[model samples]
Target: MTTTTSDGVATTRPAGQQPDPAHGPGTATRPRGRRAALRPGSHLFLVLTAAYFMLPVWWLVVAATKSNTALFDGAHGSMWFDDDVSFVDNLVQLSTRSDGIFWRWMGNSLFYAVTSGVGATVLAVLAGYGFAVYRFRGRNLAFSILLGAVMVPPTALVIPTFVMLANAGLTDTRWAVVLPSLLNPLGVYLMRVYIQDSIPPELLEAARVDGAGELRIFARVVLPLLRPAVVTVLLLTMVAAWNNYFLPLAMLNDPDLLPITVGLGQWQRLSSVGSGGEQVWNLVVTGALVSVVPLVVAFLCLQRYWRGGLTMGGVK
Candidate 1:
């Protein structure tokens, strides 16, 4: 009845040659070969989704290898190249373009992503911890307000935010992007739920009896326990901040202040008009590929931290 998957998860398979169609509609199963445990349709959807996502990426990979001319050659398969490979040349060009300003934009993005991620994570954790641990007056009311904020779309506030930032004379600066992204209402809510379920009250009480200050207790006792939720919130916030397009587009008029997202848009617009022509499509494709790398790396590298018993401390 028990079969181990590649990742070592033990799954239960029923004893039958034919699938139990009555078990559920569109959900089928069989006990044959590698298909013994795997539901018949499990892999079909997964493979389809994988192909759907990877197609454009495959195209980008192939396209990045070709010159602009090969890109426009209609006879060539969209996923294949028939011309000179210039991935290296394009990368070199990308690196050296505009007095090496691409690197500057990259650094700015890293700074914004890292700083805002850290700040947002900390605020989320503390706020969530407070919501979980403290029962002050209006706690539910305050949490309800946070839940409401989560429902409110961020784009709806763009103009009002712009007006406020303009009034404060903070527009066209890195702070303009960094400041707004630091507050994640959903992240705060998520942290609260995570802390409530994962953090141990007894542990906090034990620390308090031992004369641990709130901040000290958090640093030495709670943080290590909340690592998974912390990683989850941090990664989510980082991706959000890094991919933020509209906020930056509205606040930053100066090209120097633009993040890669906005900067890439500029390239897309410019490429449409000049020698880039149809070839500029590759830049957009290539840029998209490059932009996704950091997020993938972050997820892979930090996934371990996000896997532990994040609710161990919060449960009764």
Candidate 2:
């Protein structure tokens, strides 16, 4: 027997079979009862996982709202906001500290993340497309080298990178971080896989037959189709660049050139023995909170693109 759903998909079932206990009578409903039984357990697992990740963020939020005195006071609540709100005060303190150097670190982070993300995405697209479409000498060998690079840890390359940058007189500058960030081997691999799977050779052939040059064809035809992969690479590269610490720490000695990640670490260290030899936990918490807000906002705003990109890439 067959019946049409409200959405007009026809579903069929064998004769003499009763309706599923969880859903209606249809072939698709066979797993419904079992899935229903497992739903609560799955939901509980998801909730617990989410809470595990979010608990630290929640603690930071609550801590950001408390005064230094309240934070250290045994009588005050630890996980909740203290009696006197200190968020505004903390913000004021953080902004005025070190001649507003925290804002400079934020600007540096923005520059590095945005530029590196865009540059890396573009390079990945070009490299991925080349690897996927063109037959060349040592292509497999080159991609194998890329895969090997992916296996190697970034920390292992820091000393070597610093030496190279130092030799080129690029250390202690913005490019110290941005240049290294633009070389995302994983992004290239992802784009190669995505392009090979998602884009059909027939499309390229048709474009070629239509008298389009390789650059034109790629720019006009292929790029539109590769939006999902591009966005994914962009987000990944941006997040990595934004959160980068070690390279920046090793390469940049000037405080004026540090990214927010490194800058915040310095602040945390300074907080342990603040100016005039006093601990300044309020500034540290507030600065950390402020540093997080931009990245959080970026993720929230761009999440739709990120999600759609992943979904399309997966489906294709």
Best by lDDT: 2
Error of 2 at 186 (Å): 0.9
TM-score of each candidate structure, all chains considered together = 0.80, 0.83
Q: Once superposed on the true structure, which residue ranges of model 2 sit more than 4 Å away at CA?
A: 1-46, 273-277, 304-316
Query: C-alpha displacement of 207 in model 2, angstroms?
Result: 1.3
What CA RMSD would candidate 2 show?
8.1
Report RMSD (Å) for each prediction in the order shown. 8.4, 8.1
**What's the CA error at residue 6 for candidate 2, in Å?**
22
Model 1 poorest 10 in a row by lDDT: 307-316
Model 1 earns a TM-score of 0.80
Model 2 per-residue lDDT tens digits across residues 1-316: 2457679985432211223333434445566576567578779999999999999898899888888878888245677778788899888888887898889889998899899999999999999999999999999999999988888998998999999999999999888888888888888887887777668899999999999999999999999888756877788788888898999999999998899889888767766743554567887888888889887987777765555344432232
Clashing pairs in 1: 197-314, 198-311, 198-313, 198-314, 199-313, 199-314, 200-313
